[model samples]
Target chain A: MRGIFSDGPRTALTAFYWAFLLYLLLPLTLMMAMSFKDASFVAFPIGNWTLDWYGKVMQDKQFLDACLYSVMIAAASMVAATTLGTWIAMLIVAEGIRGRMIIFALACLPAVVPGMISAISLRIFISTIDMPTGTAAIILGHTVHAVPFVVVMALTRLRSMPGNLVDAARDLGADNVVAFFRVTLPYLGPALLGGMIFCVLLSIDDFVRTFFLGGYRPTLPMLIFAKVQGGMSPEINAMATIVLVVTAAVGLYAEYMTRRARTR
Target chain B: MEPVVQFDQINKSYGKHVAVDNLNLSIEGGKFVTLLGPSGCGKSTSLRMLGGFETPTSGRILLSGKDVTRVPPNKRNVNIVFQDYALFPHMNVAKNIAFGLELKGLDNQRIHRRVSELLELVQLQDYAHRLPAELSGGQRQRVALMRALAPDPDVLLLDEPLSALDAKLRQQMQIELKAIQEKTGKTFMFVTHDQEEALTMSDTIVVMNKGRIEQMGDPDTLYGRPGSVFVANFIGETNLLRSTVLGVEGDTASLNWNGITITANQGGLTPKPGEHLYVVLRPESIHCSVTEPATGNRIKGKIRQRVFKGNHTSLSVDVGDGTLLNALVHPSDVAQLSGEDIWVGWKAETSTVIPDRQAHN
Candidate 1:
């Protein structure tokens, strides 16, 4: 009792950190656990465990199509966001342009703006252009929302890098392009990888952006949102479980790679 | 000798602040020239201009008699080892050395050979596989040097390359750098604030002050014949006494410093009587004795304090007019004068007179 009370504030802070962690992970953990429930309905404290919901979700044609469309759209968005973000970061940092801070702030504004606001604005803007509202619209919205984050992350990494390395390479007979490729790009490797991974996950996890823009085809997030609104189901639990597992794996991999890079 | 690099009235300014002002200099081929100055004196700026990292605002830079003012750094046949060494963190020592060769599109075998040879030259043959973080500061500096020299550039620019090393390592590297420059015979333009480093390593030293060249000459000439009071005070420790020229006799001049009369050898500059002047005396040149020497300017003073250095002892002698003159005596001779009345004197040749036209008041 004395030990517990003597370290009261520190113990409280440690408890608070663990509580925050639990709060963050609770919904996903509950969804994963419910996915293995034998019952048809999703609920707490499963009496039995089974893979029937996983089988059902896999067998459903609509779910399968939505899964395919989500994968394709997310992959396309990830590629576009990463490429555009990396180019913009390099331009702002390495090119020594005027008003760099302003440009950087503008580039990062999309990520800080509310996703629903961005989605609605983008939806109205794209509608005036008479563009389709399916995978293309979803991809556009996700890319816009995710690219800013990628740019910010990439720019932070690029700015921390020693500019003298590039200058050294130039002094060593390397042309601008050669120096960038041989020196700058290689040094940006881990940051680029981490940015790409985060961009992909952000694209996949985004629901508000996909909701307004996804026309006929449903992204995984949109489908999940719809399923959750219609009431809990074992199939939705199974899908959420898969997403949680994949996101955790990717996050762990990114953390590992970034740490390894820092050691180097 | 023909000039390998020349700056013709080069001037650089940012907005209204002048960094290098109408600077003109020429470097002969196969000579080691050091730009020596204190911080903010524009020596580094001059080196950067030579390396094509900076462009003169209103003048031209020439290399081997060809105009290269607008040439890019990569196109210029000059390489620079930055002050921080700037080794690629991702690359191993061998790869770092070979980076320049690879940029030149050199063949693989030749790149390998050159890298191995340079590794041997810098005495880092066994550490080729280690990353820069794994190596010590001096080893990283060597790798940077090897990388800069791998392309066999016509000129090498070193921006205080040894400034980052420890004292012992810096001393060792000073010798190593001189040896390397001699072997390669590349026109080396180095910049440093260290007086000893500049004097020990440079074939010629260009002293700069306030964005302009103060003087440029061989180390001996620069040390012996400083053109201005700033140069005289900067290059070595000198006691610059404010004096007034009383009269001139042939090449020697009689000067009065606060009513004390002294004589010094006059260079070509002749000052009229009552003109303000400075009598520059090196500490080692001033001798302290219990009795005045037979023939030279002598001043009676009392020892204010004594500092015991390793090989010599320095004494602060107060010559009664709110002025303290420093005299260095050999440790063997220190026993003769400690807190005692003594006569401090220097030969006329050992002292030079600098007119107070732009001298610090």
Candidate 2:
């Protein structure tokens, strides 16, 4: 296995992989670097590094309020999405219900469809019903958008699990309900955890759906978009840097957990 | 003894294909019965139906005297050991065995005691803390058995439980399983595709073919008097010779081969003239001698090939009618006849005649 790296073509391929990774990370890296600039403007490769911009962002009341609102909405949306998604996945995989394929396809439809279409359609429907598009509306939109991903990930895990284990439990004198709680649920722990993490990240990072639904209360993404239109400020860069770092840390941790699970 | 479980007029079908048709069987309490068959012969399907994992399309199943046809598997007083063992990967040996007792709401002290007893019974007391993946194939099989038997079900169903082990281990486990079954005195219904496993382990064997029971009897009766040509061919090695029934006199029947006539045991069946039949002769039944025998049912043939098989020699002889017959002679008998014209003779009572069916293409 180590000998394969000695060849020129293999070396070139390895370099290409690194290059692709860097390309994907470039924008986030730049945003973080510019956040430390002494200058008031968000500029890359600044002459001086300072913490003044981060302090300014911390003190900004609008940014602080938006961050708080976004956190609450995202948390609420994730809890709703994960619960509903896990229920749907368990039913489809374990129960073998009629029209399961149609239901599964419908559950996953939101993931592949354009976010703008979903956002605008939700906006129109909510407006007709006179529902206020504030924190609650944005939370609802995020939940709708993030649920399909949770379902897909959880359902794949549930489907791949050996059904023989469940049957074995029943044969060992467990009723259907007891078997599901004792055997099936425990086996799904890691997958369900991973799905929950993914749902949280998705709900927090949503921009298009939140944009249409946020009428009075602004989420972090909407706040950042407004700052970008007002000529990129160093405060905006500082906030971006924090979001990027947190998301990257969570993403890496999730990846490590999933890889370890795969190896086992 | 009365049967502990009974399947009466059971029929199961999937779509248009019949998986098991009118399967009726009774398993006596504390007796070991084996359902033996080739693949797709419905042996596993029948066991699944009995385990309540499957329901018959039309029929009733009785446990002792109560009808349990519609009862779910978890409610039925039966347990199954799957071919793959199906041990809980996340749980250790002790937890796996205790799971059934825990489900029944047994006291913690009783569950622990029973689990320890089962662990000792399977001879894996030291491996109680080890996961299923850490154990060897045979050890996993034992653990699976302990898990199913821990509940003290009225019946135990083993589905090809030893098929996953190596040949040597399989043979060892066969004896261990028999010993365990005898010690527990629990009704056991094991299913296997291996003929030798069925013969060596079962008190009663039910041979199945194409979703139907071909024959069911003790090992000796199944081997000596198979009910059909299928049962005879499937049970053990036997040479079948095409012949026509000449007549039946008392307990023996005279049959005419291609160019010769011989007498065979009637076996309670009357044969008419011109009826094509098959004469089954075990290789060991035929005796080979250098000198042509003047008496008994004898045939002269030149030895075509002689292969040594450690304790015995297998001789194939051509008896002038383009038919090759095989005879098993011991090494001592081989010294008297080697690659020469010889006489083959068998007692009339040792051979069985069956109605000849269409030959396979």
Q: Please compute DockQ, using alpha carbons, for every candidate against the native two-chain complex.
A: 0.78, 0.64
- All candidates' chain B TM-scores are 0.96, 0.95
Those runs of model 2 whose alpha carbons end farther than 4 Å from true positions after fitting are A1-19, A52-68, A94-98, B247-250, B270-276, B293-295, B305-313, B331-337, B355-361
What TM-score between 0 and 1 does chain B of candidate 1 receive?
0.96
CA shift of A250, model 1, Å: 0.6
Worst 10 residues of 2 chain A by lDDT: A255-264
What's candidate 1's i-RMS value? 0.9
lDDT of 1 by residue, A1-264 (tens): 479889889999999999999999888778788899998777667999999888888898877887788778878988999889988898898565999888888888898898889989998999999997887888888888888878888888888898788888888888888888888888888888888788888888888888888886777777788778988888888988877787889889998998799779
lDDT for model 2? 0.87
Which residue pairs does candidate 2 place in steric collision? Answer: none
TM-score of chain A of each: 0.91, 0.87
For model 2, report the TM-score of its A chain.
0.87
* Candidate 2 residue-wise lDDT at B235: 88
Worst 10 residues of 1 chain B by lDDT: B352-361
